[model samples]
Target: MIVGVVSDTHDDQEAVAKAARLLLEQGAELVLHLGDIVAPFTLRRFSREGVKRLIAVYGNNCGERLGLLRTAESLGYEIHDWPHVVELAGRRIVMVHGKGPAGETRELVEALARSGRYDAVLYGHTHEVDVRRVGSTLVLNPGEACGCLTGRRTAAILDTETMEARVLEL
Candidate 1:
């Protein structure tokens, strides 16, 4: 399975579209948005070609939470809260928005991955791309799809069979 990872959209529809396109071109079957999505309408941009599943979590700036859920529901999708966990391809994966006091979120995410309780920990908030290994766990942050701050649009594609994460700059 090829999973697409995106974060910190910040309501930039254009960037989201580009990122989604890149993910699709790379053969992403599942797409995960780590938050900072901003508006419900932004979710529409991700409903593009060749995406099997679109999963998302709320970020610190998730305004109109209920509306977001409604939008997703209307589109036949679901948006979860932080620390969402699931087993995919026989591996436990933890998904989080990573919104909180500075280093605290990073520490918690790192701890969760280091505890060996998950095969991969996917998070976003800092708008900086990061990929690391903690024990047997893989920690990945796909950076900011909106590229509001860093000006570099990015995402990641994770190969479930090989546990490899490839960062994509759009």
Candidate 2:
């Protein structure tokens, strides 16, 4: 499976659209959005005019933005309300928004890995793309789609068959 990953799309419409377009052009079978999808229209517009199959977690910004989920729903995507688990290509993945603390991202993955509950962990908060293997599991972050902070819009592509991750700058 070709999985597309992105996070912290803090409401940059153009970058989000471009990222989704590239993912689709690459024939991504699934897209995992890490979080900080600021406004409803971010996801809403994507659903209406861009992406198709998207697995998204709500960010800290999302909690403060009311009715955003409803907007996304109306746009045709189901936003996962909290920590979610999904299976893809025989691999289990745990997804989170990553709002706990600085080093908590690693801790969360470590804890989850220790439980043997998942084969991969995906989270977003820090606007930095990272891919690391933790024991038997993969820890991945797709960075920020908005490009507000880093001045570069980015995303990730994970090839399940090879267990390889490629970062895409939009």
Give the top-scoring candidate (lDDT): 1
Q: Please give the range of 10 consecutive residues that has the lowest summed lDDT in model 1.
A: 44-53
How close is each model in CA RMSD to the real structure? 1.2, 1.9
Q: List the residue pairs that clash in candidate 1.
A: none
Compose the digit string of candidate 2's lDDT tens values, residues 19-38.
88888777787788888887
Q: Candidate 2, which segments miss by more than 4 Å at Cα?
A: 64-66
TM-score of each: 0.95, 0.89
Give per-residue CA lDDT, model 1, range 1-170, as digits (tens). Answer: 99899999898878888888899899988898898888988887677533557888999999889989998887777799988987789988889987667488789888898799899999999888889899888999999888888888999999989889999988
Model 1, residue 162: distance off in Å is: 0.7
lDDT of candidate 2 at residue 18, scale 0 to 100: 86
lDDT of all predictions: 0.87, 0.79
Off by over 4 Å in 1: 48-52
